[model samples]
Target: MNNFQQTARVGLFFILGLALTWVTFETLRGGKVFKDQGYNLIAGFTTLKELKDGDEVRMAGVKIGEVERTRLAGRRAEAVLRIDHRVRIKSDAAATIVMAGLIGTNYISIDLGTDAAPDLPDGAEIKTQATADLNSVMSQIGDLGKKLETAIGDLSGALSGGKDGKTGIIAKVDLLITENRENIGKATANLQEITAKVNKGEGTLGRLINDPKLHDELVTTLDEIKKGAGEAKNFIANAQKIVDQVKAGQGAIGALVFDQKAGEDVKASIANLRAVSDKIARGEGTLGKLLSDESLFRDAQSIMKKADRALDGLDDTGPITAVGVVYQGLF
Candidate 1:
């Protein structure tokens, strides 16, 4: 090959090597070329749930880092996680392994504590949250089944093996069934007789079910009651309507209740009557003067007397003489 061809082949191989390295790094470790921000937290639990190294550590749904190691620490299991230093986590943050999706791979989930508190120090042990362990759940279910079996066995023993050998409640019940066989047959026949009577509409209760007239009467009575109730409702509604009219000043009672014009007319009439009363008290107008003045009363009395005397004289005097007496009396 020529020198240019050799240089070209070397460049292509170098590019291939770089691409392969990138692919390999991505396969080995999750995430892109640029490292994400995170923080490391420790959680100790009895079971690690098969959490493996290189599992993603997430905080508030954002990828932070990977699990570095897991091992038995003292009486508890510990998982070492390498997290991005740039990620902010609280001292109370929780680290847990959670499944990604249903039937999917598991990932490390870090619950970011409330942002109100200060960030946790590097490699600091954080707060832990315990979820239901699969083995523990199975054990509890098995214990529940055992308790149920114990309860059932106790009940069976109590029923079958009693303190009394022969006179237990179940044994007494069986003896009673055996002794009352013929009496039970007679009682059963009596029950059948009663049922037949009821089915044939022979008893009062049966007639209540089978009689059409009583049913029709009941229906009619209900209809009448409904009609009465409707009428009562209509009457109440009309009364309410009348009350509303009175409130709105639409009728005679309404005018008395809310009519400003009627009130003003009444006030005007009262004022006129008061003026007339005051006039009477002061003896001002003709009628008021007539009512208040004693002199006018005396004058009226004298005029009535003169008329009576003149009428009495006319009974005795002739027509010409009566006229002469009246003319003289006037003069």
Candidate 2:
């Protein structure tokens, strides 16, 4: 009976150990033992960035799967993700390794692609994007700090002078001031003298500033200029009105320029005048004959001499006989 009790006790202890081991394995596997392990998808990355097996795979901050394993393929690394079968990952969905916090473990972050996109097939590779991990960022920051330190040292050297006995900016400036001290003093003295003269109204500028009469005259001149400008504006307005009237065909000049009938009449008159002038030049009309024929001039001269003789005869005769004598002489 004692041997049987000891054997039973050993058996109970072995069973207890197996139970504990099973429970620990189930917990680590997320209690998915004897259940559907889901489909696998490959995610390729330049680096896993501390990702390991059992790390959560999240979509929009919600865990939908976990990393099954990580392996290197040629020059790059890839993670095998075991995704829940119910959660369909679209073909266009991208995966990225993201950190939860500065000290938190990294996870696989996925984006919800468009609803119209087809689901990615099992065992197919999921798209991955490179992200700046904490280590890389820290390393970049360190490099930047070193570069900044070097730059600052260079600036310090430039400002404070180099080790080769070169003069710095401050030293050069001091030397310049020392060399030009007398000139600077003269310039300052001249400025003071000019200011004193201006205060005493000794020059044109001084008078313009300190003389009330000059100020009043300047104001009066300004007022005159304003009045002149106003008159000029009114003149321009009147000129513009005249121009508008002309443009509207309201004046003589406008009629001459824009009235077709008036233009035609003027053209006709000019044509008629030209015709008459041509006739005169050709000696074709009475005026033309009078102007161009020597015979008519000679006849007029003869008639004037007969009239003179008849008038002399009339002076010796009675009034009734004077008419007869004038007529007989002209006949």
lDDT tens readout by residue for model 1, 91-143: 77787778675554667788878878888776777676667656677899999
Worst 10 residues of 2 by lDDT: 29-38
Which pairs clash in model 2?
Answer: none
Query: Candidate 2's error at 121, in angstroms?
Result: 2.0
TM-score to true structure, per model? 0.50, 0.59
- lDDT of candidate 2 over 1-331, digit per residue (tens): 6999999999999999998899889768643656565889999999998888889999999999988889999999999998989899999999999998787589999999999999998999898899999988899999999999999988787776767534777667777889999999999999999999999998998999999999999999999999999999999999999898888899898898889999999999999999999999999999999999999999999999999999998888978799899898899
Number of clashing pairs, model 1?
A: 2
